[model samples]
Target: MNSPEQVPQDDDAEVVEPARPRRKGIYALPNAVTLAALFAGFYAIVMAMNGRFEHAAVAVFCAMVLDSLDGRVARMTNTQSAFGEQMDSLSDMVSFGAAPALIVYEWALKGQGKWGLIPAFVYCACAALRLARFNTNIGVVDKRYFQGLPSPAAAALVTGFIWVMDDAGFKNVSTMPGMPWVAAAVALYAGLTMVTNVPFYSFKDVSFKKTVPFIVIVAIALLIALINLHVPGMLFGLFCVYGVSGYVVYFMRKAKGKPVSVIATSTDEPDERGLH
Candidate 1:
């Protein structure tokens, strides 16, 4: 019904208007990996319930691997988003938090009855709190160090302990020789570490830009290969050492009235690299 001039003007306006942005889908590549990791955590719970403890432990380990990759993958693909971060935290809570607690409890703590369940819940609750705090404080906290023990590290400690014990044929020890108390002790330690204020190295800021001796890289590579060869045993031992190392550093810091810097410090005052 419009005149030709009016019709052309309307058409031109429609053409010139910016197109609305398309809504993104949930099926992003990195998100797919994150979901896969979540599935692995769920699968671990199922396997643990079926009395397949070793398989369940292995699944948790796989989840850890996938969890580690998801972020790096997202960054590489330029798919980093608030949604991905939130989803990753939720997945981590399930994989490194609830699943590990349930797996360890069923494997060794069930025999302890109510006593065993307490520590399991403690670890799980602590992990949840840790994740929540991490999510809330992400950019505010120093990226170079974690304020508390990372959930993955806590999960590794628990899973590795189970793996080493199982491999060494100590299945019955968990029920005897005051092992329930030992399990409780381990759980307590893990939970406390999660909520503690101790600064642990994040390794997030480490980069190749820093000059390093060639021999150092070779030594690290060989050490990692050696550990991989032994697998669960060596891995368990290393995690145990890492857990204890925090306390040792804490004590040293207390003695000195200040935290010791693990990284190199320049002679110039007001070191930028040092944790303030």
Candidate 2:
């Protein structure tokens, strides 16, 4: 046997460090909400396929509502995560981007051959581009304004049109004179607007934590009553106004000689070119 102090350890014996406990599965609540939103989008697509355009529209709208809640829920619950952010983005692409495009096409654009397909494709593509840009520029963007029309709002505009028209008995109006063009116009407007630099108010600075006047609560009740009075028409009309509000703000800022870009101006990091 070797001397005790100089004894050679068995070369084959291995030291095994204790394995770290796998991190607990990602925070479930927010991601579950995201999954629910994604399911709404999927349901919308399925409803469109089944010729239930009205139901499809409603599902898309539901997705929009859920999508809006996920981020706020995550923030409020202190469970924000990179995974949740990405999950939200993917869910949005399906709900707002793909679902709306496909639903519009099935509801109106299907009969126009390439004319209809082109605008639907444009809208979907622009949605993807807009989301990508938003992700990349998140750090440099103004929190008070979105650099482009938000995907949820865009989905709302597209699906809202379908809902109002369907409610008005315009179901499958692909053969109705000028209707396809009208659908195409709405699709093109919502789609192209997403890629524009026009800044839409984000409403992020509206803190729910602050105390508000009694009138605000009363006004909210009135607004709820107004919506309940004529759900489809009122919702569509509201979103329609919002769709053009960005242009109004952009032109107003331009005419007043104010910077129209929503990107933060910085000399120290001056490399964010073409964002405007």
Q: Which number leads on TM-score? A: 2
Task: State the number of backbone clashes in model 2.
Answer: 0
What TM-score does candidate 2 get on C-alpha atoms?
Answer: 0.87
* Candidate 2 least-lDDT 10 residues: 267-276
The C-alpha stretches of model 1 lying farther than 4 A from their native spots are: 1-27, 172-174, 208-212, 259-272
Candidate 2 Cα deviation (angstroms), residue 168: 0.8
CA lDDT of each prediction against the hidden true structure: 0.81, 0.89
Clashing residue pairs in candidate 1, if any?
none
Enumerate residue pairs that collide in model 2.
none
